[model samples]
Structures are given as structure tokens and as C-alpha cells.
Target chain A: MLLKPKTSILQKIYLPDIIIGLWITIKNFFFGKKVTIQYPEERRNYSSRLRGMHYIKTINGVENCTACMLCPTVCPAECIHIVAGERPDKEKYPISFEVDVLRCCFCGMCEEACPKDAIKLSNIYEMSMLKRSVYEKDFLLEQRGHK
Target chain B: MDFIDWIILGIKIGALLIALLSVAPVMSWVERRGSALMQNRLGPNRVGPFGLIQPIADAVKFMFKEDPVPGHVSKFYYVLAPLIAFIPALTTFSVIPFASSIEVMGRVVRFQVADLNVGFLYIFAIAALGIYGVVVAGWASNNKYSLLGSVRSSSQMISYELSMGLSVIGVIMIFSSVNLNDIVRDQGNVLFHLGQFAIPKWGIFVQPLGFLIFLITVFAETNRLPFDLPEGDSEIIAGYHLEYGSMKFAMFMMAEYINMATVSGLLATLYFGGWQMLPGMHTLLESFSLSGSLSGITYEWVRIVFEMFSFVIKVAFFMWFFVWVRWTLPRFRFDQLMGFGWKVMFPLSLVNILLTGIFIKVM
Candidate 1:
């Protein structure tokens, strides 16, 4: 459909319309409240259920992961590699647990699949790395989670 | 010229150069921070207090970065283009009076480098040469986008220059002088008086339509936003300077900002009262009895300082106006821009000149 531009003689003059624009900008410059957070000095709070970096939960210095295959089965990316082993104290434990961060889709299926609540998606979102990293079992445990 | 006159001339040139050179970096900082403030964001506030030293950091970064000249580009014009761009911008300021003359040791010193008898002509001539820089850069780059940008830029500038030159003819007629200093001095008298209220004879008050035409044309000639088809990032991908890098690119950026500053100064000088103190400023200065306490302080010197301050304020407002308009308005389509320049601006400026002539004769 073709439409004619809606312009009055005043607008056609251009000067008056431009002056109105100049007024609004000047008003904002002097009086408008800015919404900038100024990173490194101020930060926004994330919700409790916010999903970010991956972490393995621990209780009393013992890993809660029971080498449950449900998480790996549920994971769409198939990035989780867990090697289960029978130890002296524990009936079943993950001897070698690795998460290929490059491949992981960050869907948080592992957290929902864990029956023991051993795996979780933390709110610590600063996960930038210089190289492709595979999160080892040792690095996944401890109080590293922000949430 | 005598020995003292030569010395004074050298000092004037040096002072103007230093002032203009320093303003480029300061303008970069202002543009960034001012845009951020208007858009509800903080821009470059990490380097120093309110990011005051951000331009310095940017300069350092640009210095360390590797500059690569693309192999396909013509080597000679590529090297000369930035110099051509920069020199015109710097030289335009030589004729613009920053402040009225001050008496120092019984000698009169004007706050301008070289106030040519025909300063308006000199400025317009230098400005006309500025298009060559963009055209040369675009043609030498051997890129399709650059060539298109150059073509667009040259056409746009040429079209607007006609209206701009025509618009100023009204002011020239009213002032009866081509010298900028004389024009500025001519604006000092009262235009009209009704009872106690008086209107200072500013160009904006008398030749308002001409002023409007001149203002719009200046923005287009400077290749600013809403008319910035030459450097249309979305369309031409950095335009004429697409192949330029490091300091060569920096020089173009400097040229652009300096051009902006010079235009703003000219706007203030030509339309708003240039270096003329705001109304009642002299009375306000006289009301203060601080002069009696100081031994050698003269009221003339005090008034000159006030006038200089007023000039600075007007120029600064225009600078802010430039940045403000840039963020507010969207870019004009190439055809729309040309159409407006010829069809709208040209006829309007001609009408303005006609009205001014009739009014002058009748009055």
C-alpha cells in the first residue's frame, strides 16, 4: 500500500520540528535520570533460580554425586563423561567426572536430574576462559557456587 | 610589519593552534559522555574521574595498535588524504575571532591568528577545499563502498554549499562587510526598544530565516548526522576511511571533530553574538566593586574576560547541540537528502535573501 507522508506546513519548514527535537535532547541531558549500572562498581542481583556456571555440590567434604547416569542420559549435548567405581567407604562414586564446557549447552538438565542434589547450576556467570576447558571432578566440588 | 607586530602575529598563530588541537581530544570525551547521559547509559567512566582522561587512553591504544596499509590501495593519495583533511579544519580557525581585542602594554592584541579583510571568503574557500580530502581518500582506497561514499559526499557537500553561500549573503548585506570581526562588531547595537525592554541586534533576531538556512547547511556541509551519508556505517561500512587504520584513521577522526568545533564556533559567531558579553553584563561587572581593591586591574580587561567567557559559553552550547542532534535524529536517505538540499533549502534561502533586501530598503 502506498501512503502519503503526514507533514504539515510547520513540519515542512523543518526548523520548528528540529527545535522541538533539540529541546527534548537538552532536557534529557540536564534532568533525565540515567539507568547505567557502571560495571565493576555496581552490579545487578540475580534471582535464586538463575542458571549459570556448572558446579558439583558437596556435604561434609564428601561428594554427593552417586555416579547417577540419569543426568548424562538427560543431557542433550552429551558433554558429561562420568566413570563410576566402587570404593572402600562408598558403594559407588565417580572416579573420573568431566564436563566438556565447550560442548555443554547450559540447559541445566543435570541439576534437575540429580536425585541427591549433587549437581547444580550456580549464579556465578563469569565463566570466561582463555582456552577450551573441561571441568574436572576436583574443580566441580567445594564451595565455589555463588547460589 | 615591525618586529613587535611579527612577534604578536606568531603568538596569535601559536595560541590558536594550541587551543584548537587541545579541543579535539576534549570533544571526543564530551561526545562519548554526553551521548551516554542523554541515552541513560554510562560511557567510558572508568579511566579517570567521569572518564575525563578516556581520550588519552584511546590515543595510547591507537598508538600501540599495528597499522596495515591494504596492498590494493593507491599509496600516494592514501598518504596525502588525511593531511589534506586535517589542514583545512585547522586553518578555518585562523580567521575566527575567539574574543575582542585586548590592550596589553598600550598595544592592541586581537584574539585571532590572521583576521583576513575578507575572512568569510577565506573560511568558505578553505572549507570548499575540504571535499577533495574525502574524494581522494575514497578514490584511492580501491573499494566499491569508499568510492560510493566519496561520490555521495562530494555531491551532498556541493549541493548544500550553494544554499549555505546563498544564506550568508543576507547577513553580508545587513552587516555591509565580508570581514567576520566587522560583522560581529556590527551585532553590538540594539535592534529595537519597547519601553524598558531592549533586543540586541543578533543575526538570529533580524535574519532568522537566513540563520535557519545557514544552520542546516552547516550541519550538512560538516557531514553530521541526519545528513551523514558519506560515512553511513550501515550502508558503506566506514565510508571513505574503510581501509585507513591506526594514526591515519585517528587523523581523520581528529579532522572530523575539529571541523565540528570550527562550525560550532562559526554558528555562534555569525548568528549568536560572538565574544559580545550577554546583555547587562557590563552593568553587572560595574556593580561589583572588586576593581577598586586591586591596584592595576582595568575594567576594560575585566569586560574583555567576560566577553571571552560569553563566547566560550555560546560555542560550547553549539558543540553540545551538535552531539545532541547526532543522537536524536536518524540518518537521511541519499536521494531524500539531495532532494531536500535543492528543492527545499535552495528556494528557501533565495526567499530569505529577497525578504532581507526588501526589509532593508523599506526600513
Candidate 2:
């Protein structure tokens, strides 16, 4: 169904309508609240569940992973690499862990697949870098983001 | 002219040129920020405070950019078009009086560049030539869209100029002079006294319909929004200046803003009591007794300054009004624009002139 708008004689003349339009714009120009956010100095808060950068969780300065290799096995992008080695303090501990961040799909499946709850996603989304590099174990241990 | 007179004339010309040239950059900033405000956004606040210097930065960029003459265009007219467009826009400001005359060094100095006897006729003549720039640019560019834009522009200007000229007849009859200074002086009279409150004989009060017609026609004359069919970006892709680059395009932009300022000044001069002090200013000045206390020369200087200030404020308001209306109204379709001009405004202005003539005759 087509609906025709009923316009009066004053509306047809257009002077009154033009004045009303001008009034609306002037009102907005004077009283409308600005919605711009200065980007560099101000940041918006995101929810804790936001999947951003990958991180390794630690408890009492020790690794929670038992070198089970579950996260790497569950990764869809095949971005995680691990080599397991034993230490005297712990019977089963991984010698090296790296996540290829550039290839990361950020699916959070690896976090879910980890039996020890060692790997977690955090909310540090500003990940621009000058060089392409993998996230090494030592670099991932800094705990820079909010989960 | 004598030596002092020559110096004063030189001063007036220099001041007017500076004021006209500076309006472009200032208006560009205002257009951006003002439109942003209307749209509920903050625009260009990064470069200098509130983006005031953004236009300056843009000017520098325009100056340094590569100015390539497209191989397809007619070289001579392409080079001449921007100059043709820009010069008339600046020249039309010569006849407009910024303030009434003041006594300086035993000589009367008028704050105008050239007080032509046919004041507004000179303006109309010069301003009409600006269309040549657009037309020539379109013809020279060897492009279909540019040609179309130029054709539209010429026709639009010709159609609207008639009604514009006719509308001003009412004002010319009321003021009884073509001299802008005399017209402004006439507007300073008290129309009638109602108890203590007085109504000055401003053109807007006596010639309301004429003012309305003149205002609408001025928008069409300047090729501003609702009448900016020539440079219709969505259709013609910048129209006549489509092939122009760098400083050439900048020249066109400068000419546009300058034309806007000139017409705004013309509007204020004709309708809104140009350089006449605002209401209550006389009472305020009298209450302070500044006129009685000051020496003759000092009082003249003070009055001249105040009048100039008043004129500037009026012109500035109209300038902002151009931006306000630009953001408020959407562009008119080409046929609608022409129809409105001929069918509606043309007949209305004719009626207005007839009515004013009858009113004057009866009185």
C-alpha cells in the first residue's frame, strides 16, 4: 500500500516548512550534545569477556601447565608450538611455548582446551607492531591485560 | 585627489582587500565546525585550538601541491578561469560603505573604496561577470559534465538575476537613491514613535516581501546550497572545476567564499540598517555622556569605530546565516529551482514592486 502525505497550503508554499527546518537545525547547532571522543587520550572500556590478546596465567610464580600439549592440539589455526621438558621443581613442565599471534583466529578454543587453565584471553586489543614476531613464553608471562 | 586623500584612499582599499580575502579561510573553518555542531559531532578540533588554523594548513597544502594542466583542456581559458572568477568577487566590495564619513586632518574620509554613483549597479555588473569564469571553465575542460554544469549555471544566474533586480526596485523607490551611503543614512530615521519606544525605518520593516525575495535571490545568485546545482557533487562531480587541481581549485573556492561575503554585505546594507547603531546603542551612548565629554576629533573617531563595529557584526551574522541555511536546507532539484525562480519568485517580486509603488503614491 502506498501512503501519500497530506500537506497543507502553508506546507505547499514552503516558507513555514523552511522556517521549521531552520529552527530545528539552529536548535541542534546550539543545544545538541557532541558525541565525539578524543581517541588518543581517552579509551572506551570493553567487557572482561572480550577476546583480545593471548596470555599465560601463573600461580605463585609457577606454571600451571603440566606440559599436556592440549592447547596446541585444540588450536584451529595451528599457531601454538610447545616442547615439553622436565625440571627438578616440577616433574612435567614445558621447556618452551610460543603462540604465532599474526596467525591467531582468536577463537578462545585453546583456552577452553587447556586442562590446567594456564592459557587465557585478555582485553589488550592494541596489538599493532612494527615487526611480525611470535609471542614467546617469557613475553607472554608479563600479564599486561585484563581478563 | 591630494596627498592626504590619496593616503586615506590607499588605506581604505588595503583594508577592504584584507577583510575580503580573510573571509574565505575563516568561513571555511566556520562551515566545517558549524555543520559539525548541527550534526551532533565535533569537527576538526585537532589542528590549533578548535581547528581554527585548519584552513591555513589547507592553504599551505594547496600552494605546495602539484598544479598540472590537464592535456585535454583548452590551456588559455583554463588558466584564465579562476582569475576571472576571483577578481570580480573582490572588486564588487568597492562600493559598499563600511561606515559613515569621519573628519581626519581637516579632510572628510569615507570608509569605502569607491563610492560609485550607480553603487549597486556596478556590483551587479561585476558580479554577473563571475559566471563567465564558470562557463569558460566548463567549455574549456572538454568534458560533458563540466559543460552541463556551466550551462546550468549560466541559465540559473540569468533567470534569478531578473527577480533579484526587480525586488530591489521597491528599496530604490523607498530610499530614493542608488547611492548605498544615502540609503543607509535614510534608514537611520525614526519610522514612528510609540510612547518611548521608536521603530527605525529599516528596509526590513517597510519592505518585508522585498527583503524576503532579495534574500532568496541572493542565495541563488551566490550559487549556495538549495541553488548549488552548478557544482552538484553527487551528479556532476565538482562540475566546472572538475579538471582543475591545486591552487586553481583553491582560487575557485576562495572566489566562492568572497562572493558570499560580498552578497552578505549587500544584504545587510540594503535591508538590516547597514552601519546604523543597534537599538538602545544611542541611549547607552547618551547615558554615558561620551559624546559631550569627548573633544570633536575624539568623538568623531569613537563614533566611526562604533559604526564600523556595528557593520562588521551585521556582516558576520549574515555570513553565519549562510552557513546556517546551507546546513539546514537540502539542495533543490534542477527543475524545481528554475520553476521556483520563474513561476513563484518572479511574479512575487513584480507584485511587491507594484504594491510598494501604490503605497508610496498614496502616502
Encode model 1's per-residue lDDT on A38-66: one tens digit a residue: 66677887787778778888888889999
Off by over 4 Å in 2: A1-4, A58-107, A114-119, A132-139, B288-291
Candidate 1 lDDT by residue in tens digits, B85-128: 98999999888888889788878888878879987788889988
Which run of 10 residues does model 2 chain B get worst, by summed lDDT? B283-292
Q: Interface RMSD value for candidate 1, one decimal?
A: 1.0
Clashing pairs in 1: none
- Quote model 2's TM-score for chain B: 0.98
lDDT of each prediction vs. the true structure? 0.88, 0.91
lDDT over C-alpha atoms for residue B105 of model 1: 82
- TM-score versus the correct structure, for each prediction: 0.95, 0.90
